[model samples]
Target: MFLLWFLACGLVDAEGEPRIEAHRCAAGYYPENSATGCAKALEAGFGTLEFDLVLTRDDVAVIHHDPFVNPEICTLADGTRLGEEEADRVYFKDITAAEARAGYLCGGIEVEDFPTQALVDEPIMTWAELLDMIEGHPDVYLHIDIKWEGDLSRPPDTYARVVMEEFWARELPNDYYVSAEYPEPLQEVEKLDSSVVTSWSWPSFPDGESTTLVAIGHELQTTLGTEDLVQLANDAKVDELNIPWQVADRRRVEDAVASGLPIQLWTLNTAAGLEAFGKWPVEALITDYPAGDAP
Candidate 1:
């Protein structure tokens, strides 16, 4: 159906041009949040790549999905495998980024969880390491999901500044975008340098309410109505809105489009889901499989 609509709407040609963002640096192929994952996505013809950033004890940001090391996937530097119960206690906040990097082999473990992931010994990479991989490929777009877990190791502004400073130093023409569930860090980012593109990640609850907008590190704000969502985004100085595809219905898409704010849908995996969402007016679709259904 999307293929038919694609021709009718002229959305894309044989090249399939609806923007596809490789979520977690193509988590389907490599270890999630690794430099190799970033490289693989760029080589696979994905122009946009997304990864999660969590701060280490020394205020250095690194690429990792969960705030802690997972026992199922990672083995410590001395080959210590933490039990499920002990994993969460080993927080990245307790260790320096260098210590964190030296402490793990991120791939080839958890075979039952990600059987298809390629076997490689990858260090937990720094934000700088990942960014370095993208420098020569200016055509690529980087989307950062800045994770804030209420850790006071670094001030909120300091956290945002470190990340934004990397982008500012690049001076490349708008090749990056940052997103957070709340506005605190991004607000600080804007304060430091308004030139960087930032998006507020608005959440949708299961109770059928699509109006929950969180400004973490500040306050919890609710939208008066569905129609007001777009205007609220603009008023907040948000460049775009990132919503999970499961909760983004027709009205949400229409409302976003009406307000002139682009929507990037998250974690849509299957080809059918991709095709269905492609029919919408979304700016980007984020997924783990950029080169889908591959060996």
Candidate 2:
């Protein structure tokens, strides 16, 4: 009861609307990271759309989540499909943006986990196409998660430069953010355009641990100390801190707020989670169903 009151009467600013960022443009109802999904989110009155970005073989930026295509969310554009054995072998970095689009149809494969998701034949959107969609809606914000897998064989600076250059060429009208777990890409973004917002995202664990253990591990690590964590974000020239919801407890949120940086909690999907956190004063809620009413 107290927690609910605190969220309703304390956390939110009197003058500010609770900022809601649609995860993958409301992936609960539409295909994750699809153009049509984003359109639905915008039409539903969400002010922000959070999506993913991966560079194609030719260094063009395209909107997709996994470093490689997942057969569960996508399938081959050609008459022949990618066999299960070929799924992990094909890399987005090896295909041109057009080839990437011509190669697969997004939202076609039904995600068993997200049965509510409307399956539609939407093509994987290029960063350029996404920018074009949001061109007139200056109020709509974008959160671009740079999906980089550590292939130390390639320089981070080179990849960062490519991503940043793509943003520059488009000159998006709305305020957009670029973030990664590491500082290299953000550093490059800062160097290229300080005006554009940059963020640093960290998981509860190293990122591939079991889901059940992540919350416990995150609490143990971040709770032990926060000064170093706060300092690291500052050193990275990050404009904001993006932490998983599980670790953004009162103490951690307070610590981050004290550092003078606004924080965003990521990937919350339930109404219970939303209503619970809605009372806590944070920058925004990153959710799959942003339109759902929460207490």
| Model 1 per-residue lDDT tens digits across residues 23-42 | 88988888787778778887
lDDT of 2 at 114: 72
Model 2 residue 134 lDDT? 78
Candidate 2: tens digits of C-alpha lDDT, residues 1-295: 9988887774543234357898888888899999999878877878889988777777777888776766777877753445666435567767778888887887877787677789887678987887778777878888878877665212456667876787677776777788776776777777777886887886523435687686676567666764345775777778887878876776557666777777788878788887677665578889888878422
Report, for every candidate in turn, its global Cα lDDT versus the true structure.
Answer: 0.73, 0.74
Identify the leading candidate in terms of TM-score.
Answer: 2
How well does candidate 2 match the true structure in TM-score terms? Answer: 0.84
Off by over 4 Å in 1: 1-17, 86-88, 111-113, 204-228, 231-236
Candidate 1 lDDT (Cα, whole model)? Answer: 0.73
Q: Evaluate residue 143 in candidate 1 and report its C-alpha lDDT on the 0 to 100 scale.
A: 91
The TM-score values for the models, in the order shown, are: 0.81, 0.84
